[model samples]
Target: MISEQFDLSNRLGRGDRTALGIWFWELDRVLLALILSLLAIGLLAVAAASPATARRLSSADVSLPELYFFYRQFAWAVIAFVTMLVISMFPKNMVRRMALIGFAAMVVAMLFTIILGSEINGAKRWINLGFMSFQASEFLKPFYAVAIAWVVSWKLKDKSLPVYPIIFAITGFLAMILMLQPDLGQTILLSGICFAVIMVSGVKFWKLAALFGMGIGGLVTAYFTYSVAATRIDAFLFGTDGITHDKLALSTLSAGGLFGVGPGLGERKYSLPEAHTDYIFSVIGEEFGLLACAAIIIIYFAIIIRVALRLFEEKDYFTILAVTGLVTQFCGQAMINIAVNLGMFPSKGMTLPFISYGGSSLWSISITSGLILALTRRNPFMHKQGQNRRYNR
Candidate 1:
């Protein structure tokens, strides 16, 4: 059986008749493993966080199970896994077309969200869809990245494509929509990803400088205009006793020391707002220990480094830009979420990818990961031929 497995893995030729066979030979299995590991860790972290969350929300009139959130997250994980696999199997052109359609559709959904979405925590970012609420911005992110990459890469082929202005217009339009939803976190994320994509497309220094200036100005405007943004910033800056989440998160990590309090033994999660979502890293620390937290960080870094290194050799301009945009957004969000947990950055309401407990977030990231895997796959036969020559057996 082991030999058969090896044969299937090592022999990438005309005899391989299965889709899974091709995928097994071509896919970045290490990256996939790392992603699955993070998801597994998320399940454990959410399981630890769920009991308290359930109890806190439960009332005499509305009793709930302790594992309520855990169960729901598990279901979402299953769905997300299937979604990622299916998407990763799609051809490159299909992925491109999918992104174009998804971007347009999500834009419409986001606009409708502004009109009819449910307000949650002062942001109209989610549309209530009977069974589950959807955050359109989450879905928009990867699609937007791909679409921008498509347009910018065209400019690479034909110099007169006016790519920079088109990039700016699309980004500006998205930023306007995000600010209307008052989703500053997603706004900043979307802008940063767009800038990175444009930068890689070899934009002029002045153009990059202008965008950076605009980003800074946007920050200042957000600080003054958005009460939530202002409150978070002020709390981070001047309010000694007001950095409640940060303080608690740091304290929680300290409590775990090296190993942890063990599984569901995390008491600090009870006091942590959005423990299973935004602050899930802190829960991992308190329950699973600093070692577990370090492992998660290592996995994230490995994935990012692996993708960035892979892109170094890629020759296609669109593949380079799109994958770079996707991976940058992936790592950037991870950094923001983890930084917020560690009190390094002001709270951004960003969920840790594959871990944070949001259905839309989980599914959206799955789509992003799927696209990355699809774009990054090498020709299996090419890879095999190279391997054979290197061995010289």
Candidate 2:
């Protein structure tokens, strides 16, 4: 969106440059507030879920503090905030380039993961750096969105599916690695983002249909071709696998109705698996009640819809597709997680994006939202009185 005025440098000035040489904008304030709001929700959800988890993992002699997970998450939140601020200050081109670099790096990391990564929990999804594991799939979601947005946005005189194969190859390669992780969840999420970008590009329907066919074929391969995948899907369908965690989550949601049992008074936390990670929404339902859960869902929808509504005000294709990909994937995954919670879908290990309590995912998603803000920040003209009135957002 900022590019409309890029050539007219004399017409616009980068907002007060800092020692870091980064600029600022009015949109930054609004976007930052939204990001922080998600963090606040994360903190609240973690507070409700962590104590129970900690007790399970702790010894009776060593009683854990209520703030154990909360403090660690707070620290990560602080780190993520700084990371977000630094990214937000960069120029639009710089933002795009940085995301491209991240995408490229994750591509290479995924390759290495296939060759030499450890397989844990039956999914080879992590690269061990001695001290920690890096989930390349998680880190790549935002980057891939930006990279694809940057790639597809060029108004090509040639209407052909120019260089799209390369994008698909890279995307497919990443999906292959996640499938190796046996992580159908991430693979599906990645595909959803890819689909959103492709659809928004106004590409021919035949191309979309072909890709859709290929994607469904790939999922079939992932399920039947890979033993781990086949096992999970089979378990999901027959409800007969050694794995039986999702039912607990559904039960938890059923327990929490209109008003929730009130926070911290949850009985389900003790029995529900991943109470703080993939299934935190279930806890919200169980303790806070369905009304509270609905309120959380409303927050997520508001964020996604609010972002999508403003894309037309963007001056460039990159911003539109990038925001579209990011928001679409986010809301899509959130819906699936909610669906699973409601027993409308099979158990899928999908985390509730910003609200999940894992280490890397929260940090990565915060940075991703920061990138979206950086890319989608409205130009000064877009926010002017007349422009806002005209856009009708």
Candidate 3:
């Protein structure tokens, strides 16, 4: 019975005519393993942070179960993985169409959020449905990347099109809404994704420089105008009490030394706000050590490198651009989250991908993983047959 099951599961034929059959045969297994490993580590990290988080919340009469966040995060992980699998089954044209529709819906939702969303940490970024609060920006990112890549690919195919200007206009509109939400982090993050797509699409050097200058100028304006940005900058550069989180994160990381204090035995996590969400990396450091942190970083880098390597030989412009944008956004968010934990950058309140205890972040990142998987999949037999045909010719 086990042999029958294994045979049924492991084999795929060119004659097979099903979506699952194609995906099962073509999906990049190494990339999937790396992502699943990160999700597993995230669960462990959240488990470590749960007691402290629960205690802190319960003290304020928030009344959560001791492992509430961990359990919820686990549930989110399941949903995220399922979403990724379903999305990966979609064909390229369908993915693009879906992204178009999803982007429009998210834009409308974001506008509504700006008007009626719940305020958290002095930022209005979530729309509270009766069941849960959803962050539209989290869901918007992958679709936004797809939409931008689609537009840029069109310009690549037709030189007469005024593509860069259209990109700029859309970016400006989106940036305006994001800044109105006062989410400077996401505004910058999405801008980086767009810039990466533009860069890969081969825009003029002067135009690229102008975009970079605009980004810098936007940062300056944000630092001066928003107290949140200003406070983080002041804390990071001038040294202020506002850096309690940063200081705690660094000290805890340092305290862990080479190895960790052991899982669920972390002390400093109790004092750090958002330990389960934004600073879970530090919790991992404190419990599992710098070696584990390094391993995590390497896995993230490996995934990016693997994706880029797969796309190196790809001839499809849309596939290359869409995957590039998605991977850039994925690795970019991971870098920002880790940088803030290490005190290398100002606090951004961005959750570590896969590892952070947030439903929206987990699900969004899973969608990104699925997109990468679908775009990178190449049929082994087709590749072999192409090589054979070339040799014969």
Candidate 4:
């Protein structure tokens, strides 16, 4: 029996006519390649930034290895890769079901986090899971996007469902919860995802304009009402009581003008905080240069464009909306991280997706990439048949 099982697995690996084989052939290979490329780049970036972070955290009594974070990040990347592949193999219905269920679970987890979570950086966002500290909000993002998309797409089936108000309530409630955690970055991101999905769902122009105006107003309110936001904004605008991370990041990022100073040779990264997480982009810029940073941005644009092209011919409203939400969340986070590193935006503790060194972030982003893969999976044979049937009709 063992030998037979091994043979069957080998056959599947060899691309035999099995479910795994079918998935291998049907899933979007180009997008998969792009995602893997980002993961690979992430490992390299982590390796480059690990020494600085490790040293910074080292104490007189306990010394950390230079590559400690890199090693752990590598392990997380491997696990996250496997998770992405497995989730990508799930069918569309399964994906939707998973997102809905996961969203509920994450909401519960967020509630628990609010009550019993450990505080980090003066925020109660992470809950201890014995072996690891899990940030519920980080994992909530992809699920929230899919859930919102699924709920909003109901209008296509029945226009009287009041989906808009339902989504608004959900978004508002979640925003309230996130603000209580004082995670302004996530609250802003969640709002952006909600707005983008509604806009893409063909909502009225007036509503979009109203939402945009409200978004601006919300920023103004945050600046006044949220101490963290107000401080960061004041620092960015007037350089009063500014954080050192942003200044160090800008200096490190510009140290390698066009071509990098070369990998592992950046001295400025030593003083840059969160070098392996929030400030990893600056490390990349210092070690790999401005050209490398531009390349990373270009790769992000490629992934977004690739997804957009894939959705061009999609007929399912839910798929279009879900994919749009996921992509917005993914790319939006990356844009924010890069913007912060470049001193164009206030520091928001956002991680560059698939590039930052953190277990929760890696897992969350991997699940996100997996959902995108699953939703966008195309069976050429079925697609052809559907077209033929439409022609016959």
Candidate 5:
């Protein structure tokens, strides 16, 4: 089996018609290209933001390179791209199995994180793994979506199954733990994923209405309960705080106006906190211009639309739910990050999907892209009738 796999890979590399080659041809190349485009833009944005971040972080004891974050992000991007490519080659069954297993493992990891995680900025969200710190929630997001989709897809097998309740319970538990970590951003993202999945699963309109109501109520509760959320919300709504991160972000974002000041020429980014991670969108605005920011948003919309179009005729329940959930998670996060950067939403320490600097986030997003590619792969020559026959089974 190993030798056969190796031979197939060799044939794929040589552009010969083989199993691997078939996989490549069946892959959603347009979606892949869009993802890669974002990755490339992310690299440039990181490079532009790196100098300010490095300088701010530098001290008398240690001097860091100007492109410190950029170099590290570049390395992670290479690894992430390779990981995505390999995972995208997996068969559908393997993709589902991996998500199930990964979801289970990440749940355990999240528990460990709550118990023994390193505290950063008053949030215990990272587990130190010697070489690097691991954020369980980041890795858990994609897997959670796939797992939920897998569970909810069971309705087609038996309409009487309590799949919705099961999904809600799982999501609720996850949300509770996330709130314990005080990660309101991720909690909100996951809730959105669950809501999107349920909505696509044919739940009643009134039920979705109730769910949305609950979500809003939850936010209200968080405002009163979570100090971080309250502070940020107050800052956003009332402008109670002077020179907050959001204010700086908006100022930095518009500093370049339409065409930007050119890469690394913006001076405002130096004052913007989390410039390479959460506020990278603003950094891109400062250096790459508002036009680049608009283009990035368009690319995100294109990716979401591309996936929706691909799933138009999909008959498999799991495929529809899983794909919907993943894309919702992807674009939803991007929208929040962009909104926060524009001072339209409260500051959430959420990284801009593929355009932010973080090891775990980069890898998680790569996995998301890979799963999307894997689930959406189809033979171009297959007739609609043949495709339906295959999916209906």
Candidate 6:
């Protein structure tokens, strides 16, 4: 019946088609729609934002080739969609194993970047391969969630391996690479994901508290190892007087106001160095207005809350960790972008996920979201009926 409601193009939700149903609370339609919506918006945002990039690079006088960025983005969107659908259709066990393999591969790739990678904007974060370049951090997302979730779930099952040490090892290894890239923003985000997974998995509050303390200590040690990192952190918090990137982002956002200045009318975007990538949200706010920005935020929060709500009902430990970690990373990245936009935080060369432009960011985000989609799909009526049966007594 619910399948009928959503107009099932193919049989889903009963048995073989079970994974396709949107109404299933476990398969939460809203979340599915949200991910799809983001994918669609990524394409649209790329189309909208690319002309500005064209003008900036080629000057208004010269008729350059059709915007290069959007065409690449459109291609990536298709790949991302295929990736998401394929991941979603997978069985739970396969998803876990894929996570393991994927996570390990990304870790290696991330380290490899540090030693034999190209420098972009003063940081050696991307592993460039002549014709193409990819960021290991983006792929690190889903696989990291999968691997940690497995550890957490396994610990719940056997109660042997301690969570913190496992977390510390991963954290330290990746933190080193990120530091080499001089990406403190990513380092902080990774730490947050690990902390979130541990806490939500019911690790004792005392242990959680201790982990945070050690995390802070490790970061201090890191700062000493890398002066560039220490300076970025310091600059973010207490920079000398100047029209900083973060401040400029705020001005771009404020200039958009509640009703936006209309598309192609963003003057700030032309001057903003990372307009098409890192600070793309500012461009969205500038051209589409504050209301559009708020709408985007609301949609993101809704999907996150939807996933969290589902996790609360299922007793599976891995699912709990996987879902929570995914949401945390998703929201954490978005929050960082927002904070930087609002002047509450310093710039952190991060994209606004689906909304921001860039082949790497878009591809990585799309694939990661696919993992979340797989995690949340379920039979809705079955869950609802069970709830009714239990409460109606």
What are the TM-scores, per candidate, against the unseen true structure?
A: 0.93, 0.86, 0.95, 0.94, 0.94, 0.89
| Model 1 residue pairs with clashes | none
Candidate order (TM-score): 3, 4, 5, 1, 6, 2
How far does residue 191 in candidate 1 sit from its true spot (Å)? Answer: 0.9
RMSD each, Å: 3.2, 6.1, 2.2, 3.0, 4.1, 3.8
Model 6 vs. true fold: TM: 0.89
Local distance difference test, candidate 6: 0.78
Q: Which runs in model 2 stand beyond 4 Å of their true positions?
A: 1-24, 28-31, 59-66, 115-118, 129-132, 155-161, 381-393
Q: For every model in order, what is the number of clashing pairs?
A: 0, 3, 0, 0, 0, 9
How does candidate 5 score on lDDT?
0.93
lDDT of 4 by residue, 134-191 (tens): 9999999999999999999888789999998999899889988998888999998999
In angstroms, the error of model 3 at 69 is 0.7
Query: Residue 160 lDDT in model 3?
Result: 91
lDDT score, candidate 2: 0.76
Q: Comparing 1 and 3 by lDDT, which wins?
A: 3
Best of the two (1, 4) by lDDT = 4
Show pairs that collide, candidate 4: none
**What TM-score does model 4 achieve against the real structure?**
0.94
Can you tell me which runs of candidate 5 are displaced by over 4 Å?
Answer: 1-16, 384-393
- For candidate 2, write residues 201-220 as lDDT tens digits: 88799999998998899878
RMSD of 1: 3.2
After TM-score superposition, the amount by which residue 52's alpha carbon in candidate 5 deviates from its true location, in angstroms, is 0.6
**What is the per-residue lDDT of model 1 for residues 248-273, given as tens digits with 9 covering 90 to 100?**
77787768888899988889888887
Error of 2 at 138 (Å): 0.9
